[model samples]
Target: MEVETNNNNSYLSVVRRSSRRTSFPTLQGLYVSLFEGEITSDGLDLSISNKNTGKEFNPKLLKITFFLSIFISTVLCLDHGFVSCNLEYIEKSFGVGYAQSSFIGSMVYMGFLIGCLLTGLFLPVLKSKVLLIGSLIFVVFSGIYSSKSLTLTEIYASRFFSGFFQAFSIVYLPLWVEKFSPQSSTTTWLAYQQLFSMVGVFFGYLLGGILTCFTAEDINIYYMSSSEKLSSLFISWRGPFIIQSALIIPIILILIFIPGEILDVGDQEQLSEIEYSKTTGLLVSGVDLRRSTNNNLLPDENNLNKRNSKLRRSSVLLIPSQSNNPNSSKSLEIREICSNPIFMFSTFAVCGVYCFTTCTLFWLNQYFVEVIKVDRITSVFSVACIYLSGPTLGVYIGGITGDLINDYHPNGFGFILTLCTIFSFIGFITSMVVAQTHPYISFFWGMIIILFFLTSTLPMSLIVIMKSVSSKTRQLASAIAQFSFNFVGFLLSPVIIGIIMDIIEYFPFGALKRRYNPIEVGIKIMLYISLPTFFFYSLATLCSYFNCLISPKITQKKIIIANQIDIPKQLFIK
Candidate 1:
């Protein structure tokens, strides 16, 4: 058996070299990736044998997690609290009104959109570590500079620059994690990566509130009411930005410690060992046939051939060669993405949900203070606590479910996504109503419920996008999809909400100052967008369940290549 195994390896190595002659250039080269086991606690062997039953502390995974945590937290938190918690402070400092502040608020997003698009454009040439470090430096310095801005123009320029650079880190984060993640842990780790950013956003808000509460000075620079002077309400808005910027220095150190280029990530998974037999025909599962190439194995196969033959039975699907086939590179072809129904429908769903989500988050703190009649500090802290708790639970549950679905066809995800969308819509409406009706006492609970239901699906949506495309194009696909959803949906949502609020002002009771009801009405109206979002997701569910996401044949026969080991090329053709 050992002799046969060595023979198989030699034969497969030849096939691999030959295949490379025909592999696509889009992937740059034929890098055969394998999945490796994670390190376990007790300094145990990193193997599949133990199955990690003891819940070992994996040092490698821990290191990766810690690195991502710092990376994401530092990048995301750059502007997290700036627009959300301190817009009023910005307004006061610049002596600007709502319109100017809102435009200022949008500058960061604009920069992010530009950055996301840029990532996809230059992905082929971009080195992950260099790009990330450069972006982090840009954002960190920009953030610190923004803290010292004396005018609205300075703030605008600084925020845009910070957001633009932050985009590189954000765009690259998932791709790198996806690259390094073992198959067993990929889905969950992706969720955790997202979890890190989500946590950072909440922490930014919390940190801002804390700094505000503790750092408010007796000398009031901006005009302040007695309550404002005491409540950390009027001053010290710059403290959070400075602290977050300073904290980023440590993250850069962590980044520097991570070895290798960004794109050089892959996992190694063990397959069932191959053994040759002369009596019985070669057994097949997902094993590569080249592993059974030994001539010395039992003189003849039991059934396959009375006379020994070089070819062995293959089960695992074969990947196309990189340069040999013109169509191989088309696997990541842009036209394929645009023409696919599953991608289009799923993208629509993502855009809708992201729109509503971004809009709601932008206004949540203000809603609590102005409409719910909660104290500003309580509003910030309460929202922070809810975020800290709800998102972690939601994202993990969603991620776990996503991993489990690999057992089913890619279309199987549609059903889960559909259910998630429905739950999100219903939960959002209920939460909105509850917040409006109960205002203070029960609003927190309702929000917690809402976030759990809505956010639980967030990770799945991402998983859906990742699963929809080939591994080679995953980063580009993700960057494009995110850009489309965020740029279109997020950009519109805030503008739409603002318009609704402005129109409400025309009524005898429009502004919050005049009547709190407009804010409530506007929020409720915005929530209605979920209807169409659910509609599209439901359509996606149906499309996927029916196995309907196949792309058009560019006269190129498309076959479903899975994340598996090498197999005979003839066996995989459609």
Candidate 2:
């Protein structure tokens, strides 16, 4: 009897041991699942082992690194603004026709587009720091070379190299900002980045204008040969480039101090997927349960069990089936943007705005001197006012307004953009009318008000574009938008405006001559062209409205989410 009892106890103990082992495996699986989800919030804690080993990165340090990167990148954008202001002087020195002079600006933009293409393709292989440092070196060298150049072609070549290098730095800066920012802060970071860019433009115009004030007066000291004129021109042009070249040293130093990893396309894709999943879960959770219940009656327990089994099997298959190759997904995104009507419309609208704005800004100093009857000093100061006040105030106001509208309504950007278009139209008309009729003081103030409103539209347009597209495409889109502006300003504006001036000069009415005020011709041309621009912008407003309506649905379909562990293998694993 005692032997039989002891055997029974051993059998029960063995059964209990088996049950505990089985439960342990289940609990271990649950812990692993929870760990994967939890670690996703902290990118630095990617490795489970590293979580306990490394010192925590302070958030403030990250923020500083991001802001400094933006500031450095933005400093290069000043090149365009400064060069644009100096075009007349440059033309005088090179003895180039207006059409040829336009190439000086256009070649830079051509280089910018090529640089963007190169960076987009090669950034994954090269580090951001290396690209930035290389770009800065190029800019510095280009500046020094430009100061020594006598020929139009030589200057163009220098500007092209400078622009090409600057483009890489500019494109990568925003990309890096996006990479380092918390997911929810993308727009905010973008806004601030753009703000710094505008600030750069403001300072560029101011400094360029100030430097021009001290330009060696063109004393008619005729020398024996053409070489003398060329030599003097070199000395005059050298100053601006020298100043610009000196500015790059501080920017390089600032960039060297920033700490962060360069973003690869694969990493961005993974992040995009993670964000998409979270959004997808929210959408799934929002389904109306009552409506679902009304559509189907309850089944018997066995049938329900069978249905659940089928659902589990289908979900398992679907999840893996839905998994996309990161490269393929990026390609699809690019294709979608190209095919998308909203993107097309937005691109067109941006192109138009850039063309008009750049023309206005580029010729503003000329307009002030000829039409407004301001002294060179006063005109330069006025140009400075427009550049500094308009963009600086505009960005601050636009950013605040965008944040408010985004918080309260889904279609806010559309409305804001429409408002901006309307403001631009009104401002353009007011400036034209004021120039024609108002007292000098009144006209000046009116022009200032008009410019402020017109400039305000710039940030609104930028924010609208940023909000309309996926984050993955935002940098590329911004680059394209900027490229359109540069292309129009450099290649199209000078030629088109020059043609208008030429026609006015030889008009059948015999109203103007070669000695007629070029500045007056410029202002009149601006007024006339603005009428058509106003109409185009109004059409853009309508397009933006339609885009806002469909954007949510389109965005919903493209979003995806996945665990961080899945992200590494899917995105970064070779």
For all candidates, the clash counts are 18, 3
lDDT (0 to 1) per candidate: 0.55, 0.53
Residue runs of model 2 more than 4 Å from their true location after superposition = 1-57, 182-188, 217-235, 262-266, 270-332, 410-412, 435-439, 489-491, 502-517, 528-537, 544-574
Please write out the lDDT profile of model 1 over residues 1-574, one tens digit for every residue.
1112221232221111111011111122111111111111121111122212223445675557546654665447545654666656565666665455666766777788888888875655556667777788887788778766656778789878877887777777666655445544556777887677777777777766666665534443455555653443324677666666777777777778766443322210111111112111111111122322343333223422321221221111233432323455445356545554556677887777666556555666777877778887888888787776777688888878777764342223555666666766776576557645654757777767766766677777776666555443555677778677657676657656766665665545444546545456656655666666667777766665433222112112334433434332222222
Candidate 2 clash figure, as a count: 3
lDDT of 2: 0.53
In order of appearance, the predictions have TM-scores of 0.70, 0.69
Candidate 1's TM-score reads 0.70
Give the top-scoring candidate (TM-score): 1
The true-structure Cα RMSD of candidate 2 reads 13.5
